[model samples]
Target: MPTQILKEQLAISIRMLERANHIDFNGHMSTRVPETDFILINSAAVSRSTITADDVIMIDLEGNVIEGNGRPPNELPLHTQIYKRRKDVQSIAHTHPRWSTMFTIANIPLRPVVMQGAVLGEIPVFPKSQSISQQEIAEDLAEKLAGHHIILLKAHGAVVTGTTIEEAFVRSVFLEENAYRQYMASQLEYAHSLEDEDIQKTKNVVWQPNNIRKIWDYHFSKL
Candidate 1:
């Protein structure tokens, strides 16, 4: 198979993870393989800062091994379910960014008032349940993710997906930043929260999955 496209995508995925500083012993990045039900995901336990294109592992929809030497993420089903449910999606990013994690612990719905927050809008909280497993998390996210690109999982972390790695990466970074700001704003005597109308307008203007593709392509071209 022609690997030029795959290689480029992998490099972009790695760079996105690195730039966001999302690396840890557990955090990971993954992208869908073109024209197939496979995903190229970073191997488990790899440092996000040092991840190279060759460090990516290709896995089937069922989390079955395909190629590459290292272990695929235990959350493989998370990416696969999204690909199965949303054909338009080309990539998925899962991270443990600090601020987003704060919201996860606080059990709050992140509101959008600032431009970046507006770009993200509202993020729903996922309640943990015995029935909720990794395989079913994507479907749960899809239900609540109708107009949002980011979600805060209760006690888990933040999950964001996009048509390209860059889009996903940007959303992830902004989501965490917004969460941090919101927390700080709450403590101040007076902080401006977004009005309902403004939030709705942003949701209307930039929340579509297709818009993510357009934005990323423009950025990718520039880079």
Candidate 2:
């Protein structure tokens, strides 16, 4: 797909995710080209459900607006920081997913409750600096997201990265599902959690992009 079309679809998906309750007013999403520093990201204050394709703003790696008219999300630094830190990533989706936020508030590093919940590696939690300044947040997130694709913001939300917007969205959706399920099971008193071996097996199986592509295509195609 052409870059322009992909940008539009990404924006539309952001809106759909928000409308479908995968996101709320407080979160943000971003996508970028493989070789360039330019990125497409959601703006601030606009309800994600009402955002149009044109509403997606473009910015340089340094967070300067290069296209579109709207103000970028306050978390723009978070997006650019990820792009700079991980060259393999082309998209980053941040959301205040209800369940993930619950774990975040409790300072819980999510354990693998099921096959999909397993983080192949450790998912880190950043201190609640909540710095609105570009320099501060970028440096903080870089330090926080050292070894994984998913990172929880203490008392805030989670950030997910992928090679594409669809990939990021699907991962974000499942992460929230895992978080919620774990929370519900915790309440059940006798809910059985995955064994260490099972967790490792699931981690190995689900960590690859190749493993998730068909699933990503199936759902993203519907949009």
Estimate the TM-score of every prediction.
0.78, 0.86
Candidate 2 lands at a TM-score of 0.86
lDDT of 2 by residue, 133-177 (tens): 477777788767876888877777778887778778777877877
lDDT tens per residue, model 1, 77-172: 667776777777777777767777776677666766466687775677767622233666667766765656666667767678777766777687
Go through the candidates in order and give each one's C-alpha lDDT. 0.68, 0.76
Which stretches in model 1 have alpha-carbon errors above 4 Å? 1-19, 129-147, 199-223
Which ten-residue region of model 1 has the weakest summed lDDT? 128-137
lDDT of 1 at 104: 65
For candidate 2, the C-alpha RMSD (Å) to the true structure equals 2.6
